[model samples]
Target: MNFTEQALKKPRALLLLGICFLAVVVVLGFFLKNSLISAEDTDVLGDFVVRRSDNATSFFTFVSSIFDPLGTIILSMLAAGIFWLVTRNWRYPGFIFGSVVASAAFTYALKFAFHRSRPPLLDHLVDETDFSFPSGHVTGTSALLFSLAVVLTLRASSRSVRILTWLAAALLVAAVAASRLYLGVHWFTDTAAGALVGTGTVAIMSAILFSQTKQIPAS
Candidate 1:
């Protein structure tokens, strides 16, 4: 669509965009909790998680690797590439691309803003050098799965397919989040914020695209 056509759809998209924006702000606020408060929250949660750590176990270590940002991006790109070839439409890939990029940018920005350190109470399964207010793994993986779920729902012809897609997405996100915590690489709150931000990015981007589509008349 042209600029004029896109501009016309903004009204319909505004509400969802606003809601998504608010959700992000709320998540950021959580990260901005007083240093002492945030530290305590992380400490109690981190200690509890570390006490149950299975870092020596290869299972969760493997799971964590599966959802690393690179893995998630590769999978997302492959899925989007297939969709593009089959339907010869850019919308699917475009939306996925935008969602992942936005999630990643925000994740990094927030990490710098909060500068919360990773849990020091336990050994890491893998070495990481980034600030850890929000788990980039969780954010990227959640964006990949959840945004794909949204695309699946849009494409599905049956309610059952849509339901199953969303269920699978939820399970994947949950597993990745748990793996991050279990790996001693992230605090519970970091994963929580990452989930919110990732999901919210998809919500906002998809709503904007939906708005533009709604303005198009049936052929």
Candidate 2:
């Protein structure tokens, strides 16, 4: 392994990353909470993103909304389960599972807190009227990818394998986020916020899970 790779493999590196990630999340959340809402920016972002989702009028709505959501959750769960099954490590999947719950909870909390309105340029692919500050799809997809990266980095033996795994995870996250915007379902800002919150959620979850795992002795 190279110097950077070796350094990253250390427990201290992971722990430090967790600490910094959590602190960043706290700061970002505060910024979002206090920043003034801009209708002009919201509309502009919504318009630009909705262009990607111009297929909103197509029959793909069912596939985009239903299949995408189901696929994201199911894929993440399956990946986590596969890891645990092969490695006989339950805590690994546990971490991924915990990330999902936390991401969803925090996403909803921020959604309601912001009370942002949906894009008026286009109708939603699926009915959604409550709040639309941050796109849940983006956040959910981000969490899933982040979880996959963490799992792969933990278990993969080779540098090539780890790099490939992370690349795939990042691509998957981007695709999902793009799909949401391209379907005109979410504003650009919404997806951006989702990505931020989702990433932060994964980091925080990792830290919490590691702390708990530390309390248990290795068998």
Best by lDDT: 1
TM-score per prediction, in order, is: 0.80, 0.71
- Estimate the overall C-alpha local distance difference test score of candidate 2: 0.64
The segments of candidate 1 whose C-alpha lies over 4 angstroms from its true place after superposition are 1-33, 37-56, 215-219
Q: How well is each residue in 1-219 modelled by candidate 1, as lDDT tens digits?
A: 433234335644644664665367556656465554365656655664656635544666787888887787787788889878776767778778777887888888877777777876455666888888678888888789877876666545677777788889888888888777766777777787778877777777666655666643221
Question: Cα RMSD (Å) per model?
Answer: 5.3, 4.5
* Residue-level lDDT tens digits of model 2 in 1-219: 332234333545555665565455456556655776467546654664546434544534543564343466776688778877776777677767767667777778877776766655465455666676577777777787787677667645678877888788777666666666555566666777777777777766665665554342121
- Candidate 1, clashing residue pairs? none
Clashes of each: 0, 4
Instruction: Estimate the TM-score for candidate 1.
Output: 0.80
Window of ten residues with lowest summed lDDT in model 1: 1-10
